[model samples]
Target chain A: MSAVRERNSSAWLLPPRPGVDHGLRKDMRRFEDQDEVDIAIVGCGAGGSTMLQRLARAGWTAVGFDAGPFWDPERDWVSDEAGSHHLYWTEPRVIDGTDPVPLGSNNSGRGVGGSMVHFAGYTPRFHPSDFHTFTADGVGADWPIGYSDLRSFYEDIEEELPVAGEAWPWGDPHKYTYRPHPVSGNGEIFLRGAFASGITAKVGPVAIANGRFGNRPHCIYRGFCLQGCKVNAKASPLITHIPDALAHGAEVRADSMVTRIGFDERTGKATGVHYVRAGVERFQRARIVAVAGYSIETPRLLLNSANARFPEGMCNDFDQVGRYLMVQGAPQTAGRFAAEVRMYKAPPPEVSTEQFYETDPSKPYKRGFSIQTVSPLPITWAEHVMAQGHWGAELRRYMSDYPHWACLGALCEFLPLAENRVSLSEEKDRHGLPVAKFSYSQCENDQQLLKAAQSVMERILTAAGAEETMTVKRYAHLVGGARMAADEHHGVVDSSCRSFAIPNLYITDGSVLPTQGSANPALTIMALAARTAAILVKGD
Target chain B: MSLPLSPRDGGERYPGFSSVDESDHWDRATQGAVLVRLGLPPDIRFFTAREEAVARALFDQLLDQHSDPRVPVVNMVDSRLAEAETDGWRYADLPEDGQAWRETLAALDQDATERHGQGFPEVTLDQQASLLRAVQDLGYAKWHGMTAARVWSLWTRYACTAFYSHPWAWDEIGFPGPAYPRGYKNLGLDRLEPFEVRDARPAQDPAANAGGDG
Candidate 1:
């Protein structure tokens, strides 16, 4: 019997239903000249796609626009590095300071589904402690709303996307939407270390569908989770939210790069958005407008919208449009076990040990990090193997050990630092808008966090009977260029993720996150977008 | 033998499968149609003749895999640059990767020429290895504004990326490329698929890669 013939629908992408059902193909596309709606959402990635779904459901005549092309997986994609060339936001940005972040697809994705198209399904929620960073420790600002505030939104989102996970003894306010994925050999190797070190490890609550749910498919575990899943198994926004949004009488237009916020008076309120598509200039009018272009471009839009009324920028009256940036300083640890781990055969994040997720008073650092299992693709493995400053036979020996390697990445909670932020560069894009400039350096607390996280990860790896362990410190994702705070003076947006100066404008991407929690930021961004959507639906 | 100037294009493509699958399309029309171009460019897109020579020499030491025709690591890298697919970020001191390759390769050839009369590719394998060691040592002189250490790192990155992305390289590492519609079911620590190669060699001896000498 052939595996191809008997293979269930879960092994492949859900074909765009029968007739005029697929979002882009449906009778919803707007003529470029006639572009006006009640709500206009920018950058149809995670936040925009999630907000579009909720807004469409709430009966807001919403239209979403993305700068990149709408990806039709069957027509456009094959799981390869070639796909990354177009998918990643490869626009040139000046990265300054000692530890400037790795950009491109790593920070932001460029297409219809946005960064979610490339992100793994490692969807853990933020701890309650993550919300009250300032209250617990006097270093960073605390989130205006806490865990209890967004708990329902998280639960609703979990149900909608239906994440696969197991409940933990450590308090999480949500329930599993689906049964956890089966444990893999890499997971077993990681769990052995965690158990030996007396740390609690559980199946990570990933956004991957475990079984056939909605129109999406279950994870086939082909092991290209970071790359766009050819199968609709991974719960990317393209498969999960965008399709739902389009079905509900909403329109999503791609290749439309929103360059400026159209405002009679920006601080007074937003009237519409100015966008360019196919080299044709178009203006989209809306009573309500939202900017969900992730962290870099979200702030870049506000900064670029500096008009006669708002001299500096639309939301930058207090110079808070692009401040208090937070990127979780990640330090990865890899270990080689005698037994073959076959890390490549399973999903990237198989298990998560959040035992160190909270602050320990005994430790010098105020916050902590969690270690989650990870194994990179072949190209990345080869690069890292050679990075050990050896070549020839030694490098060859390491390549043979790729099947035997097990690894974990620590997501340390990062404090929002004023100096670490995005700004508009003098250099402009092809559209004449200033490129997003990134400036960041790891602070003393960040150093403290890295040192502590590295020590614990090394300890965990050592206890697992690893022949050897390697630790590498690097940057993960970017968050909080336009953070949400209660006061207008403190942040760009209010607790509702609405621009305080411009009441009609809302920002609900990673940009609105005040403090970065030690989790993959996508799920939190979606939950925040849902909460904000609820508020927008219920009025002021 | 040189590659075909233009591959024979197959007209129809079976919807879901890629060019890599022989059953899907007899001739690759589009999956990697761009990859099959009108002959190799007169000069590799990003590299100068000198740089190409250096890359050829360096990959010999970097990959050094025992294969029938050592996987064309340099050709793969040339294709990537021609497509302008590079790691988005680079050290501020380094020029844009396209220019950086030319400068660094020229520097490597110069260094080799100074030691011996010929360029990198013409040198003996042991001499090429010695030159690589010099490049790794930070104190070794650099040209065209890049440090020797940075140049060595750059070459190593491209060499490894190009080498490991190919099926020939996968064969050496015992990798079964691309589990797609058919996913792996036997995920036990030591279990493998029927086609997958199980590592028969014993584990690395403790003293072999002890991390001290480098």
Candidate 2:
């Protein structure tokens, strides 16, 4: 963290005390010592932290654990390309196959805030039709629960978090109370292109607060969203739900990496989580257990928790724990502008067009993508632009038009292919845990989606008066490992995101997304977490 | 906290994990590790002296930088090779990066010897560029025994990471570099902070500052 400037004559010099047991040590001597709680959430990321808030508000004792330490943003946050690498999940997992997935720290995260610390806060809700993709498009599995099932849950989360944006009338289930953030320069150019290209565009209902909301400051637009948000403004769970849960007597054990879900072998019910902290194995007893380790680690944990009763890994009766992984495309197309768009001047883009989200038979793709205006910072520019060069002048030529470069990319929808998945590899990680081996391949449906996005983007950028369109990259968002389904045998988790085989186990993260709509999955993950919490409150 | 295994000679099969015992110091800062040129260790860990010399020569031509005030691109490559930190996977036909670098350098030297009657490092910059283009253009030479395009990308990725991660390169591009406690307030479109510099080139022309016939 850098020197702080004052706002309202008093700036937050440091974050509030996280919890009473924020950094409690695990006493290995007391091997049988089990701190019993109402709920035990493995991973204090977006979903777990959101669930923690609800559980605490309902007056339930909850404890959360994270593999990484609690980042003291004031002191620990770094703002460079090298420094940003620390914000993402650092465990070794092989992402291979046809498309060499950049499935490392960039897509996942650890620590208290989890990946949301590095997420762009582009939290768009999935459309109502997104829940029934199988029925509408005859492709992809349908979500067991519909938009109406999680409508109020979405509202509950939106009200608590400082989310901004107007609700889309097309398929948005709930009314977003707060308005969207001001349009960025990138958004203005994108809007011009969208309007010209005969498509729809609107400001987001993103998790970023419009301005100063409560104690959190407004967006200064430092463009470090991919890195850790040092200002505590970017609505990461580190600043939002984690703090609230801690205040409500929820205990958080940072540096506690859960290795297995402890179970009663006889009844096959989850006892709690078995985690290693400070080189000691400890087990906490809980009435309920949830693994919210995003997409990768969630399934990895399930596969690792194999035992006698459920020898094929706990709750993995169908061996569907790590199958059917979906890496949705967040592709970018670079374009040169006449003047200065200053696309990188602000925070993440406020406006995004979703007119192409539905299943349009006229289009080449089964589903579509949402394209928004954006610009790359210098580091990304160096990799994607300057990297392909003849010599110094080639790199320099790309750098010379820094002020005049603009881009619009898509969070394209991806359907589950049985072959594109994650499984335990022969190699082991630093912890001696079996490393996740990926078999990902971008299918023809993805190419069709990209072609649609490319045509729309070209028209939009051409409309926005772009001088040239450069390279295109398909950045993937990890989704669909422990997918939720109405039919028990068809998917990993049931409608409530609870394991159909194991009663006490729940998988509530992006892993539960049966279908990844053309929207950033953070908002949906949080809403589902809230919905799961609401269901648990009903004693289901 | 204790990471379970003590990696020897920078063998991370997967790079960038600290003692995984705890997570504060998770990354070993492998990419931009402390830039030290003090004692020089007297020798290289991964690249052979011949490989290093030729790779450095090729990069100098590729980056159009044959001078000081340049970021240590060859050192960075050596560091990555030593750590076994790769781009994870590459083209199936091409060997791993460590082997690829060695093979490519050997080809460039051999090609230079055949044409200019000199080693790759001893050739003129023009001759060096042509030899490099043989691998890139997939010309009359098999070059690296791999596709010319793959060889080009291997060198390009290493050179780009080393060049752009430095403060010198950040200054050249007018990038404000690193956002932290001192975040931007003048954040509107076309707005610049007092510290930020405007580009001194034709803004619209994508190829404005090629400094060549390009």
Candidate 3:
């Protein structure tokens, strides 16, 4: 039998479901223009989608507003990288500071699922030390809450995402719900390299389905994880939470860009959000409003809603709304081997290790980073090659050697520097709203962690018998613009993610993260939203 | 003789692999997009005729497309600019990417004239490469009112994005093109999917051959 026929045999096939059901919007509830909803969520990505699901399940009338289209993955997403450009937020912003973070495809997303639609399926949980970074290492701020507080939510999200992996042994040790998926060639190389370097590694806890998961199909190892999974196997809130939210009477309004959060000065609370849809400005009133537009836009919205009562910006009484922005020092190193590694097979995220997650007295840096296998597609591989200053025939040569290369990425826990911030610039978007001016610069600790991380990657690759290695300097996952802290003076929101100054306003996204751990923030962000929804429900 | 736009013509590096043939198994949309990239590329909608001429020459030199059947990188970039599908952020020092592209191409011509008494497109390949190298070697210094390093960044990013997205580029690199409904079963180290091709020149480190530290 052919390989395709053998793979499609009865043993590999799941008990067939009809197909992926994306018609959840069919019976979705539509609120009247005058009706005040119980909750209004902004940006239907990881956090907002989770919030919408949880709030509606708790019998609250909620609606989510997304700036981009309501993506029917089948209709919208393509397997090609450049063709999938519509999935990213492509509105121009001014990037500055010593080391300005590149925006767009790497760090931002558009449409109903937000960046999660294009995110690699890695979903590692944050360590306990992440919450008390200041207490643990005397650097960065502490989260208002702890890991124990969100532990149950993380477990719940894991079951919902139905993560597949070996029993995790590092930090807050745990086991996954599904058995680990088969490791790919690139992943096998990472494992071998880690072993040869005397470091530990495991298969995955990626959100990509390993077995039958609801109506979602199993992963085919198609290698287009970054270009929006055409296979429903990869977990995005689009499939994981939004359909559930719709079932529970939540409405997701796509192509509706929320411009500003309307304030009620007399009540000292939020009224609703003003948004633009199809070039028409409209308002949606809600008793309580939540901003989950991730790091950049969440703070941009708050700062843009500056009224006479709070000229510095709403919830920016202490000027902490858009401060302490953080991105992981994600430098990827690719090693060329004698055999064809063909890093483009399977999912981009296959194996990872958090063995170097915490601080060591021997190391100069206070925090550490995680090493993981990263497989870049042809276009992304070309970018990786170009980042090393290769051009002309030299660039073509490296790219042609694509099949011989395997890659590893480091998620270095860079300390949040106050100077690495997002503020409104004089320039405006097509909507006439001021665009975000993001300034990012690495601190001493951040620089040290990156150097160490790159060195370790090189060491592992060299030990694994690589003929040559190329390092590409990059960053990933934006977090912390409107942070959650112990008091109003230190953060924009409280432990419950409620705005410290405005009673009815809340922020539930990666923006609420005080100190990010080395883990990918998707799972943590979803857990935080889940926690926030439960708190609101319990309080009511 | 191969046609000027033949997808099969550019797979010289990986003589055995053809991403165009591999596209037969891809889903409709993906297959359509990849095949379209191999066909007659889009017209010059964003750049002026003069700018397009300069850009075509620049992309050829930057990508080392020295012969016929070259990937239409200039056209791909022009389409991106026409649609305003920008990368979202611009350096504070430089103008928007579209405007910066126009200004820089003009500057390249001016630099060519100053050094070799010719337009950029008319200059010798060696002279063009040297001029571009001069701009790159300026690092952060100002050239034509924009940071030289940023100009290099702008040009290379667009050029690489356009070039590598083409089906011919995938063939040249031995990439098996888009795998969708048909996913891989053989996933162990050094195991190629039945349809996937192995590297023919794995022993030769291109960086070592070219003395590129990268």
Which number leads on DockQ?
A: 3
lDDT of 2 by residue, A460-532 (tens): 8888787787655657578888889876677888888888988888987888888888888887898899888
Model 2, position B105: C-alpha lDDT score: 82
* Clashes found in each candidate (C-alpha, N, C closer than 3 A): 0, 6, 0
Badly placed stretches (over 4 Å) of model 2 are: A1-33, A173-175, A386-391, B1-51, B76-155, B187-189, B207-214
Pick by DockQ: 1 or 2, better one:
1
Residue pairs in candidate 1 whose N, alpha carbon or C atoms collide under 3 angstroms = none
- Give the least accurate 10-residue stretch of model 2 chain A, judged by summed lDDT: A1-10
Which prediction has more favorable TM-score, 1 or 3? 3
Model 3 off-target regions past 4 Å?
Answer: A1-22, B1-13, B211-214
- Regions more than 4 Å wrong, model 1: A1-24, A31-35, A81-83, A171-174, B1-43, B65-68, B110-131, B139-153, B205-214
CAPRI quality band, candidate 3: medium
Predicted structure with the largest TM-score when compared to the true one = 3
Q: Model 3: per-residue lDDT, tens digit, A1-540?
A: 233122112112212442235455766799975799999999999999999988887899999999998887766777888888889998888899998888999989988888999999899999988888898789988887888999999988887876899999988899987888888878888888889999999999899868866556788888899988877788888878887778778999999999989988898889999999999999999999999999999999999999989998889988898999999999999888887788888998999999889988798789899999999998888888877777887777777778888899999998887778899999999999999999998988998988999999998888888888889989999999988888988888898999889889999999988888889999999999999999999998
Give residue A21's lDDT in candidate 1 (0 to 100): 34
